[model samples]
Target: MEKNAIVDLVRSKAEGYFERGEFFCSESVVHTINELLGWPYSEDVVRMASGFPIGMGKSGCLCGAVSGGSMALGMAYGRKHGEPMNEKMFPIAKELHDYIKSLYGSTCCRVLVRNYEFASPERKAHCVKITGEVAAWIASKLLDDPEISQKINPNFK
Candidate 1:
């Protein structure tokens, strides 16, 4: 499949997972990216993203999708113990943060969904959209950058 096609698929799956209540925002992004990257981490890897939902467990701080996207970036670029940090990690993560911030003015989940009731369909749909968008954005970053793609998953194509 074409790279864009793959990105779209990732977005759809991430959205579906959240829309179906299978996972929250951060978990959806982490799960989708981890799966797409061919399970570089174990299945238990998603556990780390569990607490980020509802803006850090309803504290309403960072957007959960953004947090998950950062985790996905780490999966791609983070270094192992004793290895120097990957040079591209910070810039790529900043790009994800800036991308969402530019679109919504804030990465705060409370701020983004403030107009809708927390339990309302509107809020869920809004979060679902953000989740999918972030997943697709990360998918594109993973696929388009040959250097990063090769490093993370040489068999991605």
Candidate 2:
């Protein structure tokens, strides 16, 4: 079956960014979204998602696409963890998760689908599709207006 049009749109966007060495999960998300929408590439996206440390090595510890989308959301709306969510975060997080998981099943890095680290498939088309679409959906929703990034964690700022 063919995928949703919007989902596919975002997926394609994510893939283009991935091709450009935007490998880190969280920052790659911003790169994917912006590049998809014709926005300029910037290092700040990488700087922000890297705030939490991303040593997962593409092992699927947490789905890179999911982590990327989550980071994108955080970058646009402020961080969601380490404090009481101010009424808009929890639902948004769940909603985002539901959107991606419904399409891809599980979001666990290694479980829903294997990671590149495992060499599961060379240029795995389906995995790329899932990750890309997930990132696009996140950008379409959370970053629809394209706000500037803020320090998600104060100490990290």
Candidate 3:
């Protein structure tokens, strides 16, 4: 499949998940990608996201979206940790994290444009937009074309 093919497939689902809430964001992204690639929408992705959600969203700590992204990235290569000790996986995870950080300014939930305060429906809508964009960008990069990183540049704010 061509690079970014996953984005087109997952964007709508990601947006829909945004409309719902933060809890579904990771599953939407993973499921969308699986459907897009015909890989069978399995619980592994959702479960992995759910597993990390605690460490990630302990009252909005780290970006759960990134954690979800990391989970998906890990599943694609291998289920391990420590920034890719295998040299090959190193570039993948590093590239994913670096790309996300460059776009979101910081993967921290509190810093990613105050997602912690995403209370009102209007504010939540904005959060959804930002999160969907971040998820899409993450999906895009993992699919291969790292250049999509420029599209979300948080510095633009």
Candidate 4:
């Protein structure tokens, strides 16, 4: 599929996952990206990301969407054991962080959802949109950057 098409698909799937409350923000983004990439879904990934929701369990650290995007980036670009860490990985993560910061002016989940009732329908809807946007951004980067895409999945196009 084309890059835009894949991004659209990922965005749609992420939105669906969020709307259905099947996963929290971080898990939703990571799982949807993996699924769209045809990668094996791992419960480990979901479990690992669960604590990041509501801004690190509502303590309000980094946005879960941003954290989830970082995890997705790691799955795509991180170095394996005995291998030097991939130099490209940090920049990609930084790019994602920058994008989110530019969009929301802050990466704190509390800041992003300020004044919204916790877990209210409005809050959930806002989070769903963020989840979709994060997934779409990652998918777009994977599809557009040949080196990164090939590193993640040699057959991806």
Error of 4 at 88 (Å): 1.2
Which clashing pairs does model 4 show?
none
Worst 10 residues of 1 by lDDT: 148-157
Q: Name the top lDDT candidate.
A: 1
For model 2, the local distance difference test gives 0.55
Task: Give one digit per residue, the lDDT tens place, for model 2 in 1-157.
Answer: 1124544556665665555555544555666555443443365556655532132554446666666677565545555469665565566667788887787677675666544544444534555665677676764564334342221122210
- Candidate 3 regions exceeding 4 Å error are 1-6, 21-23, 51-55, 79-86, 113-116, 145-157
Name the better of 2 and 3 by lDDT: 3
lDDT of 3 by residue, 1-157 (tens): 3345446545656767657654555565555444444453364656656644322656666666666666555545553555555444557767766776787687666676464455667656655665566566656665563433323222221
Q: Against the correct fold, how does model 2 do in TM-score?
A: 0.61
Q: How many angstroms is residue 35 displaced in model 2 relative to the true structure, after the best TM-score fit?
A: 6.3
At residue 42, candidate 3 shows an lDDT of 62
Give the alpha-carbon lDDT of every model.
0.91, 0.55, 0.56, 0.81
Model 1 Cα displacement at 68 (Å)? 0.5
Please say which candidate is ahead in lDDT: 1 or 2.
Answer: 1
Candidate No. with top TM-score: 1
Between candidates 1 and 3, the one scoring higher on TM-score is: 1
**Candidate 1 at residue 104, lDDT?**
86
- Compute each candidate's TM-score over C-alphas: 0.94, 0.61, 0.66, 0.89
Model 4 whole-model lDDT (C-alpha atoms):
0.81
